[model samples]
Target: MAQIGLFSSAFFTLLAIIFCFIFRRQAWIALLCSSLLTLGLFMPVSFGVLLVGTTITYFLGNKSQNSSKIGVGIGILLGALVSYKLREIWMDSRSLSLDDFWNEDKPWQIIGLSFFVFNAISYLMDIKRGYIKSTDSIFKLAAYLLYFPTLYAGPLHRFNYLNEQFDQAKITKKSFNNGMRLILWGLFKNFVVAQRLNQLQIELRQSDIGGWWTLLIGFIFFFYLYFSFSSFVDFFQGVSEIFNVRLKDNFHKRVYLSRNRHEFWRGWHITLNEWFRDYFFYWQMKFKFWRDKPYILLLLTYLLIGIWHGITVKFFIWGFLNACWILLEKRWKIPERMEKNNSYKFLEIGYHLLICSLLALVFIFPSLEGLFIRIGKPNFLPMDVFLFQKRNVVIILAMCFMVDQYHRWSKDLRMDAYFESLPSWKRRLLYLPLILSIIFFGVFMKGMDNYYLKF
Candidate 1:
């Protein structure tokens, strides 16, 4: 069933590529409509029924002048999303409990569902506060939910962003060149590096190793998966730009350069992080219970951040641990002058990575039991995974980091623009290698499924 579903989706994706070329002006609508149509074909359920119901509800929900009504409507959709546990539910597996109503499956089809939920709630809240005017066209609203480039793994987009391209029709050579590069880059990361590293990660986890060192390799792979997958976000964001749909870029380099936990969260998985801060955190801050006691408010904020990712026992512990880390920073009096010293700069980098790694380790183990069992056991390894290491995964990792670092230090932003600005001869030299590498890696790789697709 899974293979059948995957095969059909790939077939439809090829068709989507053709439509994208043909309907250049309406590419956003075409891309999304194709994805939605594909979903209906594979979904077994009627897209019309779901579309009509969601559209009507979204319109009626936004029509309200009262803040509370919009809040209630947003809350209901959020509740359905949460109840569905759309993130890690198993489809086709035997039911372990009654809550398997919305398992992970092509038929259930929660693609872009999380992004849509956040965007809708934001749209509702924004309308109530006058930050956004409701689009009268149900088609436009539906298109926003289904926009294909971002729907799989977002650069979380918004309606206002889409509004600018309303009548634009040109797909210039520059746009096509840049867009193809990005799409190819994304496919390379998704299909090549991340997938290969993931298999090794699983092998390390399931292996019978006697020490904490092997456990360290698990976390290293953790970082690899994150870097490779998140780069996909950049890749798609670039491709979407070619179509003139400027999707938001989700990563900020400041995460690598962050001075503290507070700064670090702002940089990582940033769209969702800021989404929580603005939508959930600020919303909670209005009350006297939260406002009067700052410490309590801080604790609740981090806890909410954790649970927003997943509602599980480990998620709560992960959230609480994060809150503790934040509160410690607040209570500690690290002098500002001393913090700037060279040693402190070193300390700050170490501290941020440790915090990120700790939080990420919690992410590794899904339950409290799983987390505890893995803790105190070192997992790092210089293992001879000959297949991966032989394939130059190490070299690939170094190159990926080097390119990212170069992008950071280089004053001229936008790699595409920078490349275009190069001398004609120099430009050809640079372009040939990038183009060749894409063809080389792309043909040989067995790409992974979208990581967020699990969620």
Candidate 2:
């Protein structure tokens, strides 16, 4: 493959300046600036592919003027996700490294391209259905496709939701404050909390284990990972809202607190959940003929979701497992006994925790990532990860969940007339500490990679 030349930061900045002038809009500039930020950070091949994939999808969606063709194009594109993503796997099978592109055999460097493809295909599908009207400009579509913030690991937003953020409403003082707060919050969650937990996760993953107690400890580590990750989502959403560019949020404060599988899916990675529902499940439910075939529909939709995560056996099983739970819930609803009985609540929580931990292990052991190996892998005392969960890690994990719990009951922003009712001096004192915390911790913690960068 030919090497794509890098564009300087100034180029994107200039693009931002020109668009800002023409559109008279801050969001347009903010999003274009996002792409510029990405070009600088991401490798050239990755960024090049993303720009091409997104812009092409947008243009085709606009010109085709037919939903069915768009759907087929999207299906073919989604199918290509595996082919592009699994270059390393194909090379491994052949026992040869080919210089197909870049000449460097970096297996782990797919760079979230598959995820972007998914977004593109979904956009095309939406356009076909008239959910998304096509964009006229290549630049704006480029901004939507390669906007760096959501690109690394996405809430996987749909074009319908994305186009809605093209609001011409003034970027109010409130939006600015909220955006800054969100970006700062994202930094704290990603660099501080998530990276810290990953250290423990790496160690525990490498070790061996056995017994219910060790398994319990393993589950605790997994919990920290979720906390660290979900925190990243909240932080970025806040940042996007600052630019008046709203992306879907994956973490819901409601889901973890949910008592059943149906509600849990509602709260988890909400965009993908909704994507599967809309593209696959919703239409079937709308048609009378397909009511009896709910199981097959459920099976296929979730299987696609699982495979989208990666082309691994474990990922497929993960999807299947989730599908079964959802189907069981669909067929029998959350049993009234399970819902009301206080004793079952603990079991339910444990079940949720177990499912989450096991799902996470798919990423933990990618090479041995199939059903049999996942079951057989050493999970033991001296060999097990919890044989050594550190003190600092335990403390950080505590803080991670403590924050999530706080948000469970708290809003990110609140302007009670009561806060205005407070004495000025008292309000100042309260705001002082928060301001200091954000500056001291957030500003200094921009050190590690965002977990989603690997796609």
Candidate 3:
């Protein structure tokens, strides 16, 4: 059976998009109606909490002129986020269990809280800075808060941008076609590439996968993570475009094509990074001590990013390790001449492949102890077994690489430009196989939850 969460997200998002087209003149009302339907379907409690919070913040933030009051508003939102992140610990302390959370009788359960809280903080901050005019319209505020496309996984849409797009959106035939193209490509990546790698991931975790196999598993794991995340980004971006709301681009070609760790950090899950930069990193720069020690700021930013995934030791180290690499780069800048040298570039790619592969182990294993134990137990795979165990996975991996390389070589970072450049007939012809492929490979498969939603 298809995963209900995935199926419903696609179904309701399509419903909302159609609503936008039909009620183009009354965009806010259309969005408000569809948004409520979405919340009712997927997250009824969450919708109530979000509405309460939005109502509170709208009045409090708009009227508050003092810095301390604004700080209080921001603090409350951050507190809610921190509380949700540490809820598992809270549940343990309270002797609560899965049943307690899953039981419909429970009044409080949290999912997708962080994304909403982050947006809430941004909204308050923007209001304080006079970036967005404070509004009393509950419908519009609710629509912005409850915008379904980004409620789960997000490029973290800005409130002002969303408000502007509500009325000013221009959804042309060309843009509509491009949006369709993105959604189809995203489905293929999610259904084919990510799903195939997930099977390998299950096996790797279960078997005594060690030594070189550990690194192989790690790389595959990262690939799955990338495909899963990028797929949603494509889907969300496509949906946003249809509404003429351009959600921030979270992934760019630089993610895979970048030669250095720094570049990868800058490009991958870009809006999240940008949020950290704006809210956390820049805030730290105001302090004289952290301003002098830039690396400390960098470390804190990455560590925050890691723990935001979940309050685990594994995530802490993952953030710390990335910070260390970034700091090391800052201390020893690569020579411009060496950066361009083919030999150096080749070695750099290999270096990233190795380091990233190993670092991804942090994500695969839950704790430091498990990761160390797995590393210590070296059970190298037979070449034939490794290669032949999942021939379809190998084919998909190769095809993904070829597609990425084709885009890179063509100088179209995103294939949108290239695809749009095609003749209308050619574009329609291409869309046919893509649509069929999705039906054949995607709709029937057991749907996977978005990996990031756990955060």
Best by lDDT: 3
| C-alpha TM-scores of all predictions | 0.81, 0.77, 0.89
Model 3 residue-pair collision total:
0
Q: Write the per-residue lDDT of candidate 3 for residues 1-455, one digit (tens) a residue.
A: 12645665677667766777788787666766777787776677887888787777776776665456777878888888887788667765788774465453555655567778887788777777767666768677777777777775687767887887776655677677767677777777787677777777767777777766778878878878888888877776676666666667688754665677877877799888888888778867989989898887889889999999867678888999999888887677743434667677767777777889889999767567888888887666545445665676665666477547545654734555567887889767766755665566453356753677657
Candidate 2 to truth, TM = 0.77
- TM-score for predicted model 1 compared with the true structure: 0.81
Which scores higher on TM-score, 1 or 3?
3
CA deviation > 4 Å runs, candidate 1: 1-32, 42-53, 86-106, 166-170, 254-259, 333-339, 342-347, 376-393, 409-412, 431-448
Off by over 4 Å in 3: 90-109, 335-338, 382-388, 409-413, 436-444
Worst 10 residues of 1 by lDDT: 441-450
CA RMSD of each candidate after superposition: 4.4, 5.6, 3.2
Better model by lDDT: candidate 2 vs candidate 3: 3
In model 1, the number of clashes is: 16
Model 2 is weakest, by summed lDDT over 10 consecutive residues, at: 1-10
Q: Residues 198-221, candidate 2, lDDT per residue (tens digit)?
A: 666556545554333344444655
Which candidate do you rate higher for lDDT, 1 or 2? 1
lDDT of 1 by residue, 277-350 (tens): 77767777888777788788778877877776666666778889988887877677443443556667877777
